[model samples]
Target: MANEILVLGATGKTGKRVAERLQKKGIPVRAGSRQGNPPFDWEKAENWATVLSGIKKVYITYYPDFVVPGALEKIQQFVDAAKNTGVQQLVFLSGRGEKEAEEAEKIVINSGLHWTIVRSSWFMQNFSEFFFLDNILAGYFVVPKPKALEPFVDLDDLADVVVEALTDDKHNRKIYELTGPELLSFKDTTSIISEAINSPIVYEEVDMDAYVNTLRDYQIPEDIIGLMQYLFTEVLDGRNESIKNDIEDVLGRKSTSFREYVVKATQTGVWNIQNGQR
Candidate 1:
């Protein structure tokens, strides 16, 4: 009967959307992140105690990814803390096809808390909110192309699912693999956006080493580079190349397509060139 929901990573792509939805429904939420109440920092154990106080449920979205080294340990510790601090329900935003992420999911499953796993595919918002946005604006988005296709899930869809799990007990102990309606290669994704915005954009496929070198040139952190490598090498081996129906099963409607997302985003003028740059 705990009504308070603690949304960790509250400023992130899905967490922000989840918080907005919860607030709209008049649900009580404690925004957990450096930008909000109690200022949750993943590396700071001291921040954990206060953030979990008076919280009956938690929505956990680990930053940078759950596959990087020590992520499993961190999630285990965080879940243990949540259990000890009166948090009874946990909804985890999990990465699909990530071995380490799967391990983290297991930790949550074994916890005393009632849990739901929102195992998700690549997010379509990466183009608008993350590093890919700058690349998209610059007209050339580069990546180490995965041979297997990715069905990029919409953040809106993800938020919808997360909200459902956090609010409903029926979703407890279930794992929902969230994906879009269609499979797309990296090139196809950029092409769709180009068509949507009525502007030319290109997808440049680099070898894994080349992508690593590019990150190195920018002095991107080693841990981040490790993630990029893991994603490109391990997760993209066609294991998760297919679309999943779990979103439709849970939300009772087909998840938004990439094309639909791009069209909607286009209307926001987020892709419009600004101040002589994108």
Candidate 2:
């Protein structure tokens, strides 16, 4: 029987791309989602065994955020289940400068499963696909992060590295710290967006409380708001300034630049389509 790989959070930003890339390489892939057949749900332990059946490898991406409450325990439980189910390898999509995420990575490392940790900084897609999209379309981006300079990693690059780790044994037992080539503050990031979209876009640095209130006004859940606060206040406190060469080491090339990301995202009609920007 051919080895089957399970991709957790299959519909998410990175997971979607990883599934596509793996399928393009003609590898068997099982989309592990609540909606998929033999569905997998992180909150539902009953579905785990069935979804893990016949899966030799896994690309684990926890939804919302990995640093949220109950993530570490859930990850440890999943790791145990995967190992017991005869899974041979695992690749986790993790965040940079997240102590909780690092602890979760440690669980995977000690799981006795061949593991590769893709610790990524802020995603470049955050502007094009996630929270920042609405702000970009609104002609102004607001956030609490002002001085933080993040080397926003490209989702494409992250997905490619994940595919590599799944198909090749060379990446086993390694932690890949992925990020873009250049550091850019929120102000600089807005400038890049303006340049790419050929329009004037502004960035406003509000206090952390104001940002939280804005999210509250939008009816975002409290837990998610807490996660955002933790990221802006704790994780982005100059903890990830140094760039790593993991992209070059794993993919044998330099990581994508933010300028390239802006241009490519523009071409994808990401910024061009202003409707439902979120």
Candidate 3:
């Protein structure tokens, strides 16, 4: 019998791709989103049962992530509920080299269900799809200039791995640290962006305090600012400044390179949108 998969955060970066890939292969999928049928909201735990009634597996990509405060308790609640409700498997999207994320991983490990963890590096799409996009279009990309190197991973490869994990039993009880083939500094990544967009996108490094103040000035929520601070201060502090072969080992292929991701993003034309400043 085939499992009915519930993809939490189904509209998110990784979850959307995973959902699409599963549906393409004709897997039974119930998209778990606030807008989905029998809506699933992390903050609203009351909605869990309606969404999980017939689901057997889950692709859980926590919003913002499990590192944020209150997330651990939420994970514990969700895991206990899933285990009791008879969900058979779980695939958790996790961050690489984060202690709090490690703690979150443990909840799944001890949940007494089949589980796989995708511990990922910084995403290449952050420049186009996330925090840096608006600034990139404006030609001035600003962030804390961490000296750490990052093997930025492609969401495509991540989706592939996630699909395999959800569908095939080979990946159960394993943790895959997914990353791109090469490590790149923020400067180097922006250089690729410059070439791809054929524009003068510059990378400017600022101090941590300035970055936080800027976020506050934008009236961004305190919780979001907290995640950003944790990422720049703790996760990006040269601790994960190396590459791993886990993606290739599991997929039986080499990981995507930063240049290839840049080329593809440029082809999509989303990265080249111009603002008046640019």
Candidate 4:
């Protein structure tokens, strides 16, 4: 019966923004992170009771991704725990076109709690805030699916929708497929970034096996590598090329376009090369 809302993965890309929005609105927020008070970790169920002790609602953003093995079990366990701890609502961040994610969504939907599912496409912030940033900074965007057209969703827009869902009961029992206004391939995205930053950025397409091997060579974790492979091979196979109006439906405004995101990102100087380093 507590008023504070717990945001799992509170330090992540979407969770961080959602938590900030809630705090700015003067809502009580309990950040769910290893460093948080009553710290929460997905691999550690022992901390769940402490983290959910006084939490009324929870914003769930599973780490690594929901597509991995054993994800459904973890989600099931967390959902059960949330129910036991008097959590009233759940706003789950899910991946677009991921079967495992959808299955996890099912678990929340049937949990007897107010629930909203934000099934999202690839985030535009990946170019600036995630693994792709290294490639962008290096001026070479290499991947297996350079020509796959994806309607990348802006994290800002996603955060807005998530915050609305968390605060508004009207969004409960809804599944919002969030996407941007337009579709763009990796090549097109790189070109836009290049123009925005006034730098030459190249897009290279390699085979999936080579990409996986390259990740291995870089010492990336096997789970992360498997995720990348699955994403590039299955999810990004033109399955998420279409845009959605869910953002506008939720926020009553146009979803941010990829080009618009690129323009704003450039102003932040994230793509700026400083002294031969990113």
Candidate 5:
């Protein structure tokens, strides 16, 4: 029997790619977004019951992140509802080095639904598809952590691992710490970006307070600024430097590197749009 999978955050970075990959593989995917029929909104309860009507499995990617406000409460509520609605499996996309995220994982694990957790490192796409894009386009990549090294994982690998967990039962109850094959400093990561795009992109390091101030000046939400500060100071401080073999363990191949991500994204013209040359 083909399972119906509900994908929360269906329009976001990893969720979109996972949904597309599933569809291409002919998996039945119900895109759970505010725009879809029987829309799914994390903040709205009425929409939840409708979206999980026939969903036997769920790929849970919390928007913004899993550590944000009321996320644990919301996740608990969703799990209870999913159990009542008879959801058989649950896959959560989580962040590494987050205690709150770990707590949320525990909630889902004990939710009476089969569960798997993908604890991810910083995404390689952040430079090209996320907050750093504007900075890169403007010819500089400024960051809060000057000395932090990240094994930035590729979203393609993440999507693949997610699809495997959703479709196959072997991955049930396992926690996968997913990271890239090489550890690179923010400066080194940006250097790859420069080489891939054939342009010189500079990396500038600033203190967390300064970065937070800049975010405030830009009118970024206080909650988001807090999270970014936490991630940089608390999570990125030499804790995730060692490269892991989890990708090979899960997907039977070497994980994608920073350079690979830059090259592929550049070829896709995403960087061109960022450079304002489009």
Candidate 6:
């Protein structure tokens, strides 16, 4: 029998897609979640061994983000656990332009196991599937960094790269920086979505302080709020504005654009607002 690949954060933006793609190819997959047969939770260390059993490859995506405090230590501990459990390969999802995430990447690299690090830019799904979805449904898009340009990557492209890394040896010991084909500012992003959905969406460029306050007013957790602040003020400051062709190099195809993603998402009724509900 083929070895099972464990996908942590199995229900997340990238993990879900990665797991689906692997399973579609008839590969064995162990969904690493709190609800799995052998449950896995980052906060709980006792079950690490149980979750790692018979798993030859693991996809590691930290919850919240790798920029959070103590993330490095957690990653180190998990790497050690995976090593001791006889896992052979690891594929890690990391954030672009984050020093902290880079530190965590080092842990995976030196684990003495085959590893692939995928450093990714901001995901385009933020507008349709995540935090920005509600704002878009309300016909308004508010963010702090209006001038900073980002090469927002499609999750499908990211998942494709991750699956390849897990299943192939050619991607081993390689670091892939994945980004979309074009750079876009917040205004450009909202404009594309506005045109795609045929809706008049308001775009507001607020100061970081105002954005932080709004997050607090909405009762967003302080840890998440801190991650947001760091991403907007430090990481999203044009450092990752350049496009990358790593996705093409890995998948033998071009990365999906934000406008293409918006058009596809629009057809899914995720952006459709009816009676003030999404």
- lDDT by residue for model 1 (26-108), tens: 99888988877778988898789888988989999998887666778888889999999988999999999888788889999
TM-score of each: 0.94, 0.95, 0.95, 0.96, 0.94, 0.96
Which stretches of model 1 miss by more than 4 angstroms?
A: 216-222, 275-278
The predicted structure with the larger TM-score, 5 or 6, is: 6
Give the Cα error of residue 189 in candidate 5, in Å.
0.8
Query: Candidate 1: lDDT of 26?
Result: 91
TM-score between model 4 and native: 0.96
Error of 5 at 185 (Å): 0.6
**Tens-place lDDT digits, model 2, residues 46-75:** 779889988899999987787677888889
Expressed as tens digits, the lDDT of each residue in 150-261 for candidate 4 is: 9999999999999999998899899999999998888888999988888898778899888887677657789888888888888987778798999999999999988999
Question: How high is the CA lDDT of each candidate model?
Answer: 0.87, 0.87, 0.87, 0.89, 0.85, 0.89
Per the 3 Å backbone cut-off, how many clashing residue pairs does candidate 1 have?
0
Residue-level lDDT tens digits of model 3 in 1-278? 35769999899898899999999998878989988988899999887877888778998888877776799999999988888778999999999999989999999999999999999999999887886777778787678868698999999999999999998999999999998999888889888888878788867889989988877875678887898888998899888988899889888999999999988888887875553345
Q: Pick out the ten consecutive residues of candidate 6 with the lowest summed lDDT.
A: 269-278
How high a TM-score does candidate 2 get? Answer: 0.95
Highest TM-score among the candidates is held by which one? 6
lDDT, candidate 5, 153-241, per-residue tens: 99999999999999899999999999998888888887878787787777778888888887786677887788888888788877777
Pairs that collide, model 6 = none
When 1 and 5 are scored with lDDT, the better candidate is 1
